[model samples]
Every structure is written in C-alpha cells, then in structure tokens.
Target: MKKINPHTGILVALAVIACWFASLFFLLNWHFNWSNPLVYLMVFVQMHLYTGLFITAHDAMHGTISPNKKANNFIGYLVVFLYAGFFYNRLYAKHHQHHHHVHTEKDPDFAPHGFWKWYFSFMLNYVTIIQLVIMAIAYNLLKIWVDEKNLLLFWVLPSLLSTFQLFYFGTYLPHKGEHDNEYHSTTLQKNHFIAFITCYFFGYHLEHHQKPGMPWWQLYKVKE
Candidate 1:
C-alpha cells in the first residue's frame, strides 16, 4: 500500500489537472447556446478538478504523496502551481502550525469567528512575493497559448472556488465553534458521498485530526 499510494497519488494529481484544463479547452472551443445553464454546471465540475489539485498538494505536505521526499515535493509543487500561485514551503509551515496549535491564536487557521473570515485569512496567508512572481509568469506563459476567458474560468476562477471549497470543508466547518474534544474538529457531513464530493472526504475532518498521518482518501475510513 505504501509504494502504490505514492505512485497512485502522482497519477491522480496529474489526472485532475489534465481534467480541468482539457475540459476547459473543449468548453471554450465548443460553440454553445448563450443561455445554456449546463455550461456553468460543467465549469463547477471542473472546479472539482481544481480542488483535487490542491488536495494532492495537501497530501504532499503531509509527505504521503511518495516515500521519496524529493519526488513527493516535485509533484506537490507542480500540482499546486498548476492550481494557482502558492508557495509549498509556506503552506507547509502554516498547516503544521495549525495542527500543533489548533483553536488558538497561534493556529494559523484559527476560525472561532466564522467561515468567511477564516477563508480570507487562509488565502491571505498563503500569498508571498515569490508566489506572486510565479503566478505572473504562469499567467503570461498561459496567455500565449490559452484564451483569456478560458484562463479565467478554468485556471484562475476555479482556483478561487477551490480556496473556499478547501477552507469551508477542510478547515472552517471542521474546526469552528467550541468543542471539548482534543482535536476540536467536527464531522459536519457524515454522508460518504457528500464528504467525498465536497473535499475528498475532508468533511470527515475530526478523523483527520485524529489521524494526521493518514491520507485524505483514507480519512473517511478512520473510526472518528
């Protein structure tokens, strides 16, 4: 399982990224009815691919993407950059602080106030000069080959949606409010399908805190 998980992880990460941009390519080129609602529906589906990309990076932060540290970090950086501008080391540090100091001021993800506040805080903390430069380069390079609308809807907008998805399901909903448990995490949605759809079973967040070393795919299986 250990060996297969890393191999599988990289493949899955690449697959999600391909799904997002490839679908966007097709969607942008295809002439569709102006009022077609399914267009938005499909865009939201592509947003799931964005969510998957970030989730893969999150797994890499936990060092579960591969047994080989270098390979894991490589894949993590690729998928995260593909998602949008983000510094892996910065995210890693903040996430570790979150786990170690959950619900406290020191917890980078402290969300006692509510969901929106936490989401913005999380997003703001991930940005840095290096990340901005990387994003700018990516934007210029992608614009050379991709349509502006496609880039916004598929690459940029979806990445934005993915942030709310990650924070709402992965952090705020899980760790909000007063909880007496050691981890202070919650299982807001126990339905397996909902958990899977929302954020790759991250809705079972207490299980995550209970088993930090476990991969996101296996979080739901934990007896939280």
Candidate 2:
C-alpha cells in the first residue's frame, strides 16, 4: 500500500543483474578448470556476488527499491528463486517483521542461539564461509537422496535456503536496541561496518530501522 521510488529500484536491479552476468561469465569459464587456483578464486568471488545479489533482492522485498508492490513482489520472488531456491513469501515477511521489531534480542530472526546452536550462536553473529560450504554440501547430499534429481536440489535449492537463512539471522540477530529507539552502543556501530561489506551496505541497520520507507541509496545519511 505504501509508495516507493521506482527509478531507484530499477537502477539497483539493473546493477545487480549486470554484475551477476559479468561474474557468471568468469565463473563459467573457470568452472572448466578445477586444477587452477584462479578458478577457485573466481568461484569464491562469484559466490560473494551471488550473496550480494540476494541482498539487493531483499531491498526489493522491503519496498525500498520501488513503489509498485507487484514489481517488488515479482523481483523478490525471482531473487528468492534464483539465489535461495524457495518461495516462502509468507515466512519471509513474517520473520522479517519480527526481525525489524525485535532485532538483536533473544527471539530475533537472526539469533543464532537456542536449540539450533550450530546455526545461530556466534560471536560475530554472521555466517562464516566454512559454514556456507558445509551447508552447501549437506543440502546437495540430501537433495540427491530425496529428490533423485541433482540439478535444482543440488545447486539452486541450497543457495536459496542459505540466502533465506542469512537474511533471517543476519538482520534479526545483533541488533541491540528496541525498534524505533536510539542505538545502545559502539559495538553495534562497528558491527555495521562488517555487515556493510558482507551485505553490500545493507548493514546500516540503525538507519534502516529509522527510515524503513527510504531507499537503500538514501539510508546512509539517516542520523542515529
């Protein structure tokens, strides 16, 4: 129901797509030669780009990318399918709402605590590259055993799941103050830098919390 800036969203979407295609070119070319360390390096770079693309897609879901709900939903789902492999819109919305409301608390969406300790608990409260690799392997193995189809289940599905998990956990956990309230500490500020790099500058959580209606490009200027 709320309006957003269409031009900003289109530009971001275009930028993400262009970067993704460029990265894909290098990744595909390098995929042919596993013996070369450069291939592995390119793979790592591509994976990060893949994650960043998903983050941009998240911007769409938040309606920060456009005023058109239909366009936002379509772009959001496409990113989910391409990056995360699932279509859990209801789940994403519900969890993200809680993430904005609770953020960094015990019940926060990104909390790595509780029974799911391995996935949730961490000092940095961010997913490690090693964890991602392990999850990728596990997801592929399960998909092969369950679906008997190797393609989507192996590569695409796991990537989607990981992206969703990252969105849920990364944004929800590590937030220290109540929503709409002033940020509580310097630690949060420092963490934002790390998040910025990992999430393509979506890590400016305090600014975002203050101005949920603003586009990502304009959120950096929000005062705490």
Candidate 3:
C-alpha cells in the first residue's frame, strides 16, 4: 500500500542489469565448439542462468524487490525487451498488482492446487526452453507470412509476454494462500525453494509477500 521509493529501485535495478549483461557477455563470447557435447552443456547452463536472472528482474518490476517506482518500471521494461522480448505497459502492472493483493486463487494470474497439478502446471505455466524455441520458429514463420518490418515481435514480444505470465503463475500463483487451500505447508516452502534455485534466491516469495516494501537483499529479514 505504501508508495515505492525511486532511489532504492534505481540502484537495485542497475546492479541487476550489470550482472545480467556481464553474464550474457561471457556466455556469448565464450569459445564453444558447437560439435562438442560439453560445449552444448555449457550453453544450456548459461541459458538456465539467464532465465534465473530474468526472474530476478521480474521481482524488481513488481516493486517487491525495491520501493522505486521509476526503477521498477525501467527495470521491468529492460527485462522484457532485452531478455524476454516483450513490451507490456499497463497489463504487467495490473497482473502484478492483482498477484500481490490476491496471492493465489481463481485469479486469472494464479495457479490452481494439487501436487502433480502444481508441478506439471508450473512447468507448463512458466517460460521453458521448449516455449522459447517454438516462439522463435513461430515468429520467423509469421514474419515470412506477414512481411512485417519488425521481425523481432514474432519471437521477442511473445517471449516477454509469456515470461511475464509465467512469473505471475509460477511464482505468485502457487504461493497464494487460497490456492494452497489456506494451509501453508512444506510443499509451498519447496515451491519457494524451487523459485529460489531457479532465480538465484531473489527474495523468497514468503519474505516478499510478507514485506513487499523491503529491498531484495533484506527480504529474508522478514519473519512469517
């Protein structure tokens, strides 16, 4: 409910951007023999790391990682364009705000309950390698058909949009109390852990949900 402070958000956003770009530069420049399996493995690892960084950026966008509105918007835009490749202005805000307010439920943004339900649901809900590949192919094919000047939209735009949706469903939805049947259990904790491992522990969901105003590093300071 409190207004986000811009100064803290800018600082955090800059740091996150620096880390993301640095990792990307390293991965792109690394000498990799496409013919070698190890090189392919390295590529896969780098991709996963990039995904994690992207997730961190998502937290920043929600202002859950920092209190800077400008910084949150800027970082959100950067993440969407540079990493995920979409440009959602109002929709991102609406979806994210609803997530914070509702946690999880029949909310279009959250996931429904069940163990296997959560697993398969989350996997399908999030932006995975398969989704990225399919998007890329679809974009190229669409460009060929549409003859559009901006070919990036076909893949990049959808990737960004889908990534944002995934962030909402995969992270926010599962942790919603309603979706969890009003019982916070180990499964929910594991969900947070999975998000942490996937996202470099960018402020666990429990911490963020409890204290949305805290910066990313300090989120863990909050106790349930």
Candidate 4:
C-alpha cells in the first residue's frame, strides 16, 4: 500500500494538535455561563478531536501515515501520547493482536461476557504505566497555569468521553458478537456518514481486517 505523502500527513496531524491546543486555550480563557448547552457541545467537539488523534496514531500503527517506519512510529507516538497519554508501542502491540486474533478468546479487545464487562476489559488493556505518569505530570504542570475546572472540562473530561466513543463505535459495535468469517468481524453501517462520524471508518471492521494496509479515508470505498 502506498502511504500518504509524509509532509502532507505530518502537516495535517500537526494542524489537528494545534487546533486542539487553541480550543483548550479558548475554553480556558473565556468564562461561559455554566447552564448553557453550547459549552457541553463544545466539549463533545473536543472529544472528537481526541478521537481523531487516536485515529491518526492508528494509521501510523498500520504504517499508512508515512512510508518511513521511523517517521510513522514517531508521529504515532506523539499524537497518541498527547491524547490523554499512552505508550505508543503498547497500543501498537495490542492493536496488532486484535487484528491477528480478532474475535477469538486471545483477542485483547474481546470479552466473552456483556457490554460493561467487555468495555472494562478493553479499557484495562489500553491503560499503560507511561500514561499514568504523563497524566500526573500534566496535572501538576497545568495546576500552576490552567484552572482546574477548565482542565477537567476541556481536557480530561473529553479524553474520558472519547474512550467510550472509541470503544463503543470503534470496537464493541463492529466486533461484539460471534462470527464465522476468518476475521470474525462485521461491517456495521452502510452509511458512510455514520461510519466516519462514529469512529473514522473503524465501524467497517471486516474491511479493515481484510485490507489493514489501507488508510482510514480509503476504507469507505471497500466493498463486501
């Protein structure tokens, strides 16, 4: 698979991070009426930014973001770690495991039980020690400069919300149940809009498993 132009891809990734930083700054500086609904809406928008950061890292994991392996891993590490903190190597390993084993018992994304338990299992494996350390450092650093309410509402809270969004739309919905196929995954919505809006085409689990080399933007063209 041909990777995206390294310059373009890196620029786009940097633009997103810049936008997120700007949004956080604006939210921190501007005091809003607590009872207003727009503030909450803005938070969800920020949540999607977090999810986009994850998806960006995910592309790098598949080696689709850059032709150069070093650049790919570097971009993946930066974006993913910036998304509420994570060790990029751990994420790469676990995600590769899901693609290899998929719906089987060996799959890290799978839990044989109900949604709550499965989600718990998914999250347990996702968290890493480096993430905790980064979070602590970020909290301490931000305490000196940013308001606690702004930090929680604009940064920490969106990250937590994005976990559910990614887990539900990306993992649980598409690969939750039993499957007979080789990959043991399913295509979710035929609606391209929903697919992108949900999890950046991650809902197309079977397509992704079949053509793991393809980037997120191209997955919508995949056919059953």
Q: What's the TM-score of each model vs. the native? A: 0.88, 0.61, 0.55, 0.92
Best first by lDDT, ranked: 4, 1, 2, 3
TM-score of 4: 0.92
| Model 1 lDDT on a 0 to 1 scale | 0.78
Q: In candidate 2, what are the lDDT values of residues 48-82, reduced to their tens digit? A: 56776676666776776667788777877776555
Local distance difference test, per candidate?
Answer: 0.78, 0.53, 0.50, 0.84
Q: 64, model 3: CA deviation in Å?
A: 5.7
lDDT of 3 by residue, 41-107 (tens): 5444444444544655656655654455665666776765566444546446655654545534533
Better of 2 and 4 by TM-score: 4
Better of 1 and 4 by lDDT: 4
| Candidate 4 per-residue lDDT over residues 1-224, each given as its tens digit | 45556566667667777887788789877578889999999999889888989988988989887787898889899988889788898889999998888877779998887889989999998886777898999998987988888888988899999999999988888787788789878888688988888888889988998999877777888853
CA shift at 94, candidate 1, in angstroms?
A: 1.1
**Who wins the lDDT comparison?**
4
C-alpha RMSD for every candidate: 2.5, 7.7, 7.8, 2.1
Q: Using TM-score as the measure, name the better of candidate 1 and candidate 4.
A: 4
